[model samples]
Target: MGVSDLLSLIGLFLAIIAFLDSSERKFILNKFSNRDFFLVSLYLILVNYLIFYQWWTNQIEFLNYFEFEGFPNTNTWAYFISIILIFWFLYKIMYAYFPNENKDKVLQFYKYLIAKKEYQSLFSYIEKYDFKKLRSKKVDSFQVILLEEIIGNKLFLKETASYNFFFIIELLNTNDNKVLENNFIYSQLTDQNSYTLMNIESPNQSFFKLLFHNDEFFLKSIDHNLRHNMSDLILLNKYILKFYLFTSQKKIVENTEVIENVFLKIIELKKIHILNKYFSNFSKTIVFDNNNSDSFASLFDLIVNQLNQSLIVFENNEELKFSFNIILDFSLNHYEKPYLKTKVIQSLTTKIDSENFIEFRKSLYECWRKSKKENESFNNNIIEKISNY
Candidate 1:
């Protein structure tokens, strides 16, 4: 190979290296705005053209080292091939720098921030803009990458007050449902130990609150986690109960199925305290009008059966006795009719066998008697009925 040919090869190799580097470190190219990208692309094109023109005019041999015995016009073919590759690289650079959609632009900017490790700036950017507008597959992909970075660095383990950890929480709080819906990101964030850490570190349960409130889809996801024993049952139940409490007040009709399904899962898990809290708040929301009365009755029956089974299973447990008393107490005191309370007591008495019924009555009676002593307004009639049973 002549020196000119060797120089040409070196130039092509440099161009290929530049393209590969730009491809791998896209954040660099993405840093340019559309105008800047166009200018840079034009400059690169001019430089490439100048080099090609010099080679063509000076009769610079193309790949002189290779013997092109069969093909008489190898030089022309090589020149065209090189031109095609150079333009292809330029096209890719353009695409990276000037994404088609706003979401893609946001995603590219986020990639730039992450690549530069400009977390503080990224946090500010996240706080400044509403990410709901950028909900897309690219955003979801970015979120997964961001979450992986947070997890890999054990950033969540940091004190919640720290900016780094706060940034993570903020990112999670602001992103769209697609981010949380990603199975990998969901599992990482909701992993038993990681979730426990987040719960402890977060103030006022903000992490869980934002997480559950942002999307009803998570209710089903959480249910699946609970069923598979992939999450902390008690912690999740607490959050779900809070979610329902807030959602019920809004009367979002769409959330009815979501609420019921999550509640049923909690019942299946037999979280007595959570169940008591949910039912106490839930009963107040029911209108009991003609439209929903039958549904309420059916749900009430299901709850009664589950509670009855729980009472049997935890017959000797004091906590269960207190939960039962609370449920009954709330049902009686809060509602004028108190028929739901009556139905619950009747279910417990009739569902259990003779021996178990006696023990349940005795436990409930003692709990009510204790509660009566603590509060003067406790009903004596219920106590008398239980004692007689």
Candidate 2:
């Protein structure tokens, strides 16, 4: 190949690399409008045509059969177009690989807004920008800077502006290291203090619904926070439970480790209300799969052990009775038939004593009666075992 042919080949190669890198690394294509795509396509076609026209005419003999009476001469523009396209491709590749320019511009704009306390404009800008079009790292940087500004100013804590902050947070990508690393941002997203700050009396079930669609992402965040001990488990455990319950209703909890981790924390904290909420929701939404018997057994044992602990620890009879009813409801609703053979009934009833033993039996019977008709055999087996106990 001649020098011109080699240069054209390199240009084509660079263009292809730029396109692919932008598509994968920067997600630049997602930001492109239809007009931008059309222009890009036209430019590529023109460049490719200039690069290959002479080669195709010379290298391939079949073109001799065509009428080239009015065709543009390759000598006129091929070398110049080839050189221009090469530089353009190089620029694109560099932009895709190192997108700091765009990120810096965005950060500067946001800083200006924050400096001027243009809270409304800042929120509008955030609302208008498509975060998915940006690289995750850029989005993460934006979140860190924005969060620092908000927390520093205490801008969003006011009753009038709190919802705006929450709304902006809802738009942010939750699966980011920077956002998670910022303790105040992490607390606002996953802690109970968020509700109090927002003046919400209860956990908003759909608060995280929009932020987390992937089960693994949500689970990993929970696991990471718990593992690092970054969160106040006492204040956040209920919100965590609420998030799990919300996710359970929307989708299956696929990662058992995260589920186990969260549950262990809840049990460790002895948040009976959260536990009751979890069991109540688990019974309704999660099916007990015999295939995952080991996991089921582990989780069951943890909860049962907690219940045994509750029996001794809880001074309030009503709280103890509430716990009993919740566990009974969960067990009877989900466990399969021949409950004695399954070891579920035995593990549950093992802690019953002469005092609340009558209450436990009554709760068990009530749960049996409340259970679905198809669960009669399972409930009957549980009741028979309890009578023998």
| Each candidate structure's count of clashing pairs | 0, 0
Error of 2 at 384 (Å): 7.5
For candidate 2, the per-residue lDDT at 363 reads: 57
Q: Which stretches of candidate 1 lie over 4 Å from their true place?
A: 1-27, 30-189, 193-197, 200-216, 250-307, 315-359, 370-380
What tens digits encode model 1's per-residue C-alpha lDDT throughout 1-389? 23365368559867765876443455434434676657656645644544465465457566454444776454455455556755755665443333433446656566575566655555554444433323333555544554444322332322212333343455545554444334323443345544432563232454545555546446545655656775444444444444444434333334455455556666577667766665554444333321333344444444445455556665555666655665556445433445444543454345444554566566656766666544332344345555655
The model with the greatest lDDT is: 2
TM-score of each: 0.42, 0.39
> Model 1 misses residue 383 by how many Å?
2.3
Model 2 clashes, total count: 0
Which of the numbered candidates is closest to the native, going by highest TM-score?
1
The residue-by-residue lDDT of candidate 2 on 1-389, one tens digit each, is 24567566868776765766321333333333455457667765766665576677788788767636787665446556656755765555434332444655555555665676666665554444533333254445555555555433344332124444455344444444333223323344433334432443265544465434545445655666676665555334445444544555323234345556765776667667766665554433334333344444444555665555454554434555666666676666556544323657555666554555554565555555555344556646566666665
C-alpha displacement of 288 in model 2, angstroms? 7.1
Question: For each candidate, what is the lDDT?
Answer: 0.49, 0.51
- Which sections of candidate 2 miss by over 4 Å? 1-109, 115-117, 126-282, 285-291, 316-326, 333-335, 338-343, 349-389
